[model samples]
Target chain A: MPIIVNLDVMLARRKTASKDLAAAIGITAQNLSILKTGRARAIRFSTLAAICRELNCQPGDLLEYVSGPEPEAAEGGE
Target chain B: MDKIQRLSSRLRVLFLAGMVSVPVLHAVGWAFFERIMATPPLNFSSIFGLSWGEPPFMAGPATLAMKLLGFCSSMLPGAAAMYGFACLAGLFGRFGKGEMFSAATVRLLRRLGWAVLVAQGMQVLHGSLASLILTMGNPPGRHVVTIGLDSATLAETVTGVVIILASWVMDEARKLKEEQELVI
Candidate 1:
C-alpha cells in the first residue's frame, strides 16, 4: 500500500523548512513528522484544519488513498 | 480446559486463598497476643517487647467487628486492583496478543499514565493530611489509619504508573518507527 504523506512535496512547493512549517502550524516538529509519515492512525479535525491553513493546501493535498493488503493472501498467510 | 485457562484459574484461586488467609492469620495472631498481654504477671517483657506499642487491636465484640470491616474496606480494593491488572496482563500474554504498538493502545496507555500521575497527586494529598494530624497532636483515631491507607494506595498507584509509562514509551517508539518506514 502506498500511503502518501505529501509533506515533502508540500515543503518543496511552499519553499518552507520542516521546522518553520511545524512552528507555523503550532505543533511540534515531531508531531508534524508523525502526520507527514502516515504513522498517525487518526487526526483531529482542528489539527487537520490548522495544517491545511498553514500549508495553504487543501486536505486532499495531505492525504492519499492507498491499497490496503489483499485480504485472501493476508488471511492465508496468517 | 486449555493450558492458559487452567493456569489462570489456578492463579485466581491462589490469589483468593492468600487474600483470605493472611488477614485471618493476622487477626488471630493479634487476638492471641492481646490475650497474653492481658494476663497478669506475664513479665516476659524482653521477648514480646518487639510487639509492644499501643494496645493491640482485639478481634472480639462489636469493636472488633467494626475494626475488621474498616480495615478490609480500606485495604482490599487496592490489592484487588493490583491483582486485576496482573490478571489482565497474564491473559494478554496467554493469547500471544499483546497491546499492539498502535495508536489506540497508545491512547489507552496514556490514560493509564495519567492515572498514575493522579495517584501521585493522591499521595501528596495524603501526606499533607498526615502531617497536619501529627502536628495537631490529636488522638490517633481514623487519622492514623488514613496515612497507612494512603501509603498502601500510593504503592499500588506507583506500580500502575510504572507499567503505564513503560507501555506508553514502547508504543511511542513503535509509532515513530512505523512513521519512518512510511517515509522510506
Candidate 2:
C-alpha cells in the first residue's frame, strides 16, 4: 500500500519499546506489531487516538503516504 | 442464536437422513427395478399376484449383458439423484449454520447441478438401451429405435443448469465475503 504505517519510527523516536507502547495504548503487542508493520487493513479512530495519546504523537507522525505501486495480493492455490 | 441453532440442528438431521435415504431407495429400487423393465414393462402375473412371476432370466452372454446394462441404467439415475440431494442437504446445513457465503456451500451447489445433469443423461441412455433390448427380438419390421427423451428429462436438465448458474452466483458471493473478511 502507498499509505504506509510509520508507527515503528514514532515508537523509536519516543524511545518506547513496542511492548510498552502496546500496553500503554491498551492494545495487544500482536496488534501493535501489525500496525507497525503496515499489515492492518483499517484502523479504528479510537485505537488511533489511544495510540497517539500514549505515544504523545500525531496521527500524521504515525502514518505516512509514500507513492508506491499497489501491494501484491496474498497467494492462494488449490 | 437460538433460532440459528435450532435451524442448524434440523438441517444436520435432514442431511443425515438424505445420506441414508439414498442407499435405502436404491436398495428398494434394486428389488423391483429389473422387473419393472420387463418386456411388457410389467408382467400381468406380478400385478395380479399370480405367483409373482419373474422376467425370463437370460442365459447367454448377450442377454446377461443386457440385464447388466439394465441394472446399471436403473442405478445410475438413482445414484445421481441421491448425490444431488446429498449436496443440497449439505448446502442447506451450512446455510442454517450461517456459513452462507462459503466455498463449501458453493462447491456443494455446483456438485448438485452436475449430479442432476448426470442423472438425466444416464436416464436417457438407459431408457434408449433398455427399450432397444426389450424390443429387439420382435419379428420383422418391429424394431423401433426411438430417441431417449421425455418431458421430465427436459425439465430436470433445465433445473440442473439453473442450479449450476446458482453455484456461480454463490461463488461470487463467497469471493465478496472473503474480501470483506480481509478488510479487517
Candidate 3:
C-alpha cells in the first residue's frame, strides 16, 4: 500500500485522455481507470512499456513510493 | 465453455429431480410399509440394511404414535438426501450460468459435503430407530435392536471427506484467481 500510481499525473502532464491512452496501450478503459486509481494489485511489464511508449515518459514518472500508509481514498482521473 | 454449460445444465436438472424424489419415495414407502416388508428383494428391511434374528412385525395395531415414529425414522436419511440434492442443484445451476468459481458455488459445495457426511450418520440412526419401531409391538422378549454397517457406508464417508477437501481447494483457487485478475 505504500506504492502509489501517479498515472493520472503523467496523463495530465502529457495532455492525454485516459480513454485514448487505454486504447493506445491495448487495455480496456476500466483497467486504465483501475491503474489511475491505484486499485490495481500490479501492472504487467508489457503494459508499463506500452504506456511509457505512448506517453513518452519513464516508468518512474508514473509510479512513486511513500513511507506512510496509503490514503483512505484515491483521487483518480479528472 | 459450451460443453461445461451443457453438462452443468443436465446435472442441475438431475439433482433437482433427486431433490423432489427423495421425499416422495419415503412417503410412498411409509404408506405401504407392511406390504413392502412382506415383499422379497424389495422389502423395507432389505433395502434399508437392517436385520433381525426374527422377522419384525408391527405389534397389535398401527397406532398414530407408531406410524409417526416409523415415518420419522425412515425419513431421516431421506431428509439428508434431499438436503444434499438441493445443494447440488444450486451448485450446478450456478455452473450452468458460468459462475463456476463464484463464492455461492463454493458455499453450496461446502454445504453438500457436510450434507453427505450428515446423511451417512443419519443412515446409521435410521437403521437403529427403524428396527426398534418395527419390533415395538412384539412381546418384551421379542424386541430387537440392530446396527448395520457395510463397505458402502465407509465409501460414502470417504467420499464426503473428499468433497469437503475439494471445496476448500476450490475456495483457495478462487481467491488466487481474484488476486490475479486485479493485476493488470
Model 1 chain B: weakest 10-residue lDDT segment is B44-53
lDDT of 2: 0.68
lDDT of 1 by residue, B1-184 (tens): 3665556556656655654654454445334544544664653221221113233232332244433433343233333434444444443343333334566545545555555555455444434342332223334452332233345456767777786777778786876666544331
Per prediction, fnat is 0.05, 0.24, 0.81
DockQ agreement of candidate 3 with the native complex: 0.46
Candidate 1 off by > 4 Å: A1-78, B1-64, B79-87, B90-95, B104-160, B180-184
The number of the candidate with the highest TM-score is 3
Q: Candidate 2 — which residues are off by over 4 angstroms? A: A8-37, A44-47, A53-55, A71-78, B33-68, B92-98, B133-145
Q: TM-scores for all candidates?
A: 0.33, 0.66, 0.87
For model 1, what is the alpha-carbon lDDT of residue B165? 76
DockQ (CA atoms), all models: 0.05, 0.22, 0.46
Where does candidate 1 chain A have its weakest 10-residue lDDT segment? A69-78
Q: Which digits, one per residue and each the tens of the lDDT, describe model 3 over residues B84-149?
A: 999999999998998878788888999999999998888888888877777788888877777877
Candidate 1 interface RMSD value: 9.1
The candidate that achieves the highest lDDT relative to the unseen native structure: 3
Error of 3 at B123 (Å): 1.0
Worst 10 residues of 3 chain B by lDDT: B46-55
Better candidate number, 1 or 2, judged by TM-score: 2
